[model samples]
Target: MDLYKIDKQNMEKIIGSNFDLERGLQNLIENNLELTLGLEFVASEFTVGKYRLDTVAYDRDLNSFVIIEYKKSSKYSVIDQGFAYLNTLLNHKVDFTLRFNESFPEQKKVEDFEWGQVKIIYIAGSFTSYQMDAINNPALPIELFEARKYKNGYMTLNQIMKTSIPARFSHTHNQHKREVADKGINIDNASELTAPTEEQLLETSSENIRDLYQSMKDSLLEWDSSFEIKPTKLYIGFRLNHRNVVDFLPQKNALKVWMNLSKGELNDPEKLTRDVSHTGHWGNGDYELKIKNDEQLEYILSLLKQSWQQHRIEH
Candidate 1:
C-alpha cells in the first residue's frame, strides 16, 4: 500500500525506505511495543538454550508469552522457526517465568500463565508467497506482520491476514507437511493451550444475566463486522482493530461492562460510568459500569461507540 501526504489541497506521495539493519527494526518495535502492538515488553535478545530470541513480550490480556522475531531476509522458514521457539518455551517454562518475574514488579507463578495462548510473530519488510501460504491455517498460532518505513519519518506495521482457508482442516497438516517430527516436536497436542470459550464463561451466570450478555454481544457484532468476541479467563472482550474496545463480565445477577477508554475521555452526560482509574481492575481502561437490564442499553452502546472511535483513531 502507498501512503500520501496532503499539503495545500495537493497530494504528495510519501517515498518508502528500507531498514538498513534488523536491529534498527527491532529497536523501533521494542521501544513502542505497547503502543504499536498492545503488548508489554519483557526482554531483548533473550537466550534459551541455543536460541537467542529477538524480543520477548507478554500479553496481559491473554496471560501468555509472545515471541517476536524480526527479519530483513525472506529465506528462512517461519513455520519451522516459529515452532522451534514454541518448543523451546514449552520445554523451559520456568526460565521464562523467572525472566518475567525479574523484569517486572508484579510476580506470577508458572501455572498462572496460560501456556496454550503462547504465539510467535514474524515482522519483516516483506514476506515470500510461500511463507504467507504456510500460515494460512486458522489453527496456527503464528502471525506474520509487514513493517513499511516511509521517507517522511512515518512507518506502518500491518498484519498479513490469512486467506480464506477452511478451519476444518486437520490441525496436524502443517506439522506433518513441514516434517517437524524429525526434531521430536509435536504441535498436535494443543489441548493444554486451549482457552475458555464464551459458553464456558457464561455457564455460571443466571438466566437474566446470560440473556443480557447475549443481547449486548449480538448488538456489538452486528454493529460492526470488524468487531471480534474474545473470551478470556475473566471476561468476554469485544475487540475492534485488534484492540479491546469493551469487555463484559457476566455476574449472577447483572452484566458488568468495562469500556476501554481513559478516565475523562468518555462523555457521559448521564454520569452512569464509575471511574476506576485509581482502583485495581481486571478489565482494560478506567471506566466501568454494571447493567442488570437493558433499560439504558442504547446509551451504553453510544458510550461504547465513543471508545470504539477512540481505539480506531489511536490504532
Candidate 2:
C-alpha cells in the first residue's frame, strides 16, 4: 500500500506483493487487446451493441467466440462471476451461431452451439467449497489453482488449462492407455496388401497389404475426409470418429478388435466367436492386419466395412 517507494530495483518485489493476478490479466488484455482474443486488437472494452464483455476470444477455425473474465479472489469463491460472464456472452450472441463452412469450404464444419456445448470456466488461485459445488452437478467448467511466480515472478495459466471446459479425460487418450494396459501378445506381427482387386490377400504373408490398405483408405476418405482408421487383426475399420464407434461396444475397452477370420464372412463370424476372442483391445486404435492369405484380407476388408454398419443397425 506504500505509494512513495520509487526504487526501480525493488519494483519486482513490490509488484509481486501486489501481483493481483486477476487484475494483471485484465490490464494485460485491456492494454493489448490481441492477447485476449489471441488475434488482432479489437477494442479495449468490446461492446456488442449494449452488452460490455471483459474480453472476446474469437477463433476462425470453428468460427467461435469465447468470453473471458478475470478474477482476483481474496475470498474463496468466484462462481457467480463466471456464471454472470457466461450469461452476458450468451445474451449478446442471441443470434451468434458458429458459421465456419461459410468461411473455409474445405477445412471444417460446425452446426450450432447449445449452452451445454459451451462452457464457462472460473480461474482463480484457490477454489472454495461453494465454488466447487457450483461446478459439480451440472458440470460447470470451473477450475481453480494457485498461480505462482516463475523464478521471475511471472507465470502463465495455460499449462493446467483444461482441454475443454468441464474438461474430461479425452476418449483418444483413454483408448491409448487402455491398449497399453493390456498385455500384448509378443508375437512379431505385420501385414500389407496392394491393389483393391485380387481377393485382397497379402497378409503377414506378403508386404502388399500396405499399399492395398492405403489405397482403400484413401478411396474411403474421398467419401468422408474426416474418416480415420482403427486397426484390428486382419484390418483397420474406417469411421467418422473412433470414440463414437467404440461407445457402441460396451465392454470392449482396447482399440484392436479381434474377430474370427476363419469363421467365415461377416454374417457367420458371430458363430466363429469360439476361436475369436478379443485382443483385449476390442475398441478403436491403430493396428496391423495380421492376415496370412489374401482371401482373409478380402473377408476382413468386406467385414470391416460391413461390421460397423451392421452394428449400427443392430443397435
Candidate 3:
C-alpha cells in the first residue's frame, strides 16, 4: 500500500524508513505489544537453554505464551527456527512458568495455562516466498508479520496472510520423528493441540440457547469481518484486532455475554448490562448480560457495538 501526505492540497509520497538495528524493532514491538498484537509483554531477550528469544509475550485471551522473533533480514528458515523455539518452550515448561510468575504479581500454577495453544510469531520488514510457503498450512502454529516504518513517525504492521491452504503432512519422516522424540517432544495430532472447538463449546447449551448464540455470532461477524471467534476453555470470545471485544458463555437455559469495557467506558442508557467490575467473573470485562431468547438481541448487539467501538478507539 502506498502512503501519501497531503501538502497544500497536493499529494506527497511518504517514504518508509528501514530499521537500522534489530534491537530497535524489538523495542518498538515490545513496548506496544498490547496495542499491536493484543498480547501482554512478559520478557525481552528471554534465554531458554542455548536460544535467546527476542520477545516473550503472553496471550491473556487464549491463556498461552507467544514467542516473537524480530529479524532485519529474511535470511533464516522460519519453519526450522519456529519449531525449535516451540520445542524449547515445551521442553522447559517449568522455566517458562517460573518466568511468568516472577514477572507478574499474580502467581499461577503451571497447569493453569493452555500450553497447547502456544505459538511462534516472526516479524520482519519482509519475508521470502519459501518462508511464506513454509507456513501455508493451517495446522501450523506460526504467524508472519511485516513491520514497516515510514517517515513522519508513521508505522504499519500487517500480518502476511497465507494465500493458499496446503495439505497437512500425513506422517512425519522416521528420522525426523526419532530426532524430535529424542528431544522429549511428542508430535501429537493438531486437533488435540488447540482449544476446544466451537461445536464442543456450544454442546453445553440447549438447542434454543445454541440458536440464540449463533444468531448473535452471525450478527457480530456481519458487523465486522475482522472480528474473530476464539473459543477458550470457559467461554467463546469475539475478538477485534486480536483483542477481545466481547465474550459469550452459553448456559443450559441462557447465553451469557460480557463486553470488554471498563466501568465508565460503556454508555448504557437502558441499564441493560450488569456491572461486574467489582465481582469475580470468567469473561473479559465489567459489563455482563444474559440472553435467554432473541427478543432483545438487537439491544444486546447495540451494547456489544459500544464495546467494539471503544476498543478500536482506545487501541
Best by TM-score: 3
Q: Could you tell which candidate, 2 or 3, scores higher by TM-score?
A: 3
Q: Estimate each model's TM-score.
A: 0.78, 0.35, 0.84
Residue-level lDDT of model 2, residues 25-133, one tens digit each, is 6666556544323332223355654456555554321134455555566464445555445444545444333222332334442334323223333344444565554
Per-residue CA lDDT of model 3 for 1-315, tens digit only, reads 567889898998887766888899999999999889989998999999879999999998889999999999889988778877888887788888999999899898878888867889999888899999887755467899988898768888989876663332333234334444543457752333443556667876899999998888888888788886777778889888888899999889999899999899888888989999999999999999988998888888899988888877875
Q: How high a TM-score does candidate 1 get? A: 0.78
In model 1, which regions exceed 4 Å deviation?
5-17, 163-189, 196-215, 218-229, 240-243, 250-254, 261-281, 286-295, 309-315
lDDT of 1 by residue, 48-71 (tens): 977999999998877899999999
* TM-score for predicted model 2 compared with the true structure: 0.35
Report lDDT (Cα) of residue 197, candidate 3: 50
Clashing pairs in 3: none
Q: Indicate the residue-level lDDT of 74 in model 2.
A: 46
Error of 3 at 315 (Å): 3.2
Candidate 3 Cα outliers beyond 4 Å, as residue runs: 7-10, 162-184, 188-192, 264-272
